[model samples]
Target: MAAPRVSVFPSPQELGPALAQLVAERAAGGGDRFSLGLSGGSLVGLLARDLPAAITGPATTGPAAPARWLLAFCDERLVPLEHPESTAGAYQTQLLPRLPGPPPRVLTPATGLPPAAAAEEYAGQLRQAFPGDDVPVFDLLVLGVGPDGHTCSLFPDHPLLQEEDKIVAALTDSPKPPPERITFTLPVLNAARSVVFVATGGSKAQILKRILEGGEEQPLPAARVRPASGELLWFLDEAAAKELNIPVEKHSVL
Candidate 1:
């Protein structure tokens, strides 16, 4: 696995646009269709604020067009679309509308079904969307690191962490709220062309140190996310990077 590229910003204010720029560049350089996985949390606010800003300009016909993108949530709460906890709902209302040209195709989990059934249904959606691959390989996956080192709905020390058979798995005990959720398994996360983890605030500092430097025997959920044959990145604000000792690219305000 390749080592992650760590970029530290003065604050999330600066990190947001930088993250957006990276997305724009990835979308511009990849295949005709760009498949992207998204995670929730503060990342929602960050991307919703800066992604559209970074993607500005007239929508021209090209591989980089937003119309060709496929947007899927890395994990989603089993709640009504209007519910506050719904990741899909947040993006629909906030991020999608702001992008230029025709909107991207979005795949959302069936919130009405039971957890196991929902996971199965969502897996079927991915299979249809990426028919050629046994495991769907997304072009870019935007993930977040929980203070507990969780990513997606896979919490630390959870049995879900051992999951390898399912592309999507359901969890009833999320440690974090809403309890029930469907998340992409590590196989899918590791299959991405690029994985970027955005973490901010002082609450993330200690765990960032352990995840980036400790190299534990049993790695944290976030630490275990090393994309196979793909690039891994960590975008941290100064507050979150305070405890780190390794070399990092320090970004300035644009």
Candidate 2:
């Protein structure tokens, strides 16, 4: 396994802009489109602020705007688009409006189904959106770690951790509330071209320590998120990095 590179920032404001710049750079390269998977939490709010700042500029005379990119959810609650807990709803309310152009292609699950059906529908959506000889490689994936080290709704000590065949599955009994959710399985998550974990707050300090230095046998879910050949980065704040003894580099945008 490769060593984890942790980037410590003083605040989310600093980390968010850095992440947005990285995404823009990745998307700038020639490709059909950039596929980005996002997670919901306090992380989304920070992204809302940073992404617009990075992608948009002062209004100026122009013939046309740049082509919009694609946005997909790495995991989503089994709720309607209008539901309070809907991940897509959160992004629409927070991130989409601020972005320039019509809107990115937002992929979401077919609503009004049972959890299992909804999960299968989402998996089908992914397969269609990213058809290939093998698993689709996401351009970038932004993730958030729960206090218990869960990422993309995959909780530690759950049976979902052992899933291997399916690329996505319905989680019916998440340790956290709002149990019904659909998430990308480990195989799909590890296939991403880049995976970044945005973890902040002192509440996450202990778990961050465990994930970084704890033995593989006592692994946390966040510890298992290794990309096939892509880069893995952790954006942490001082409070969150408090218990981590490993050396972390400070980032500067200037």
TM-score of each: 0.97, 0.92
lDDT of 1 by residue, 1-254 (tens): 89999999999999999999899888888576889999987889899999987777743345667898999999999999999999999998988888888889999999999999999999999999999899999999999998899999989999999999999999988888899999999999999999999999999999999999965998999988989999999999999999999999998877
Candidate 2 lDDT over 2-33, as tens digits, reads: 56689998877788888887777676655667
- Against the reference, the lDDT scores of all candidates come to 0.92, 0.81
Give Cα distance to truth, residue 118, candidate 1, Å: 0.3
Any residue pairs clashing in model 1, and if so which?
none
Q: Give me the displacement of residue 112 in model 1, in angstroms.
A: 0.6
Supply the global lDDT for candidate 2. Answer: 0.81
Distance (Å) between predicted and true CA of 250, model 2?
A: 1.3
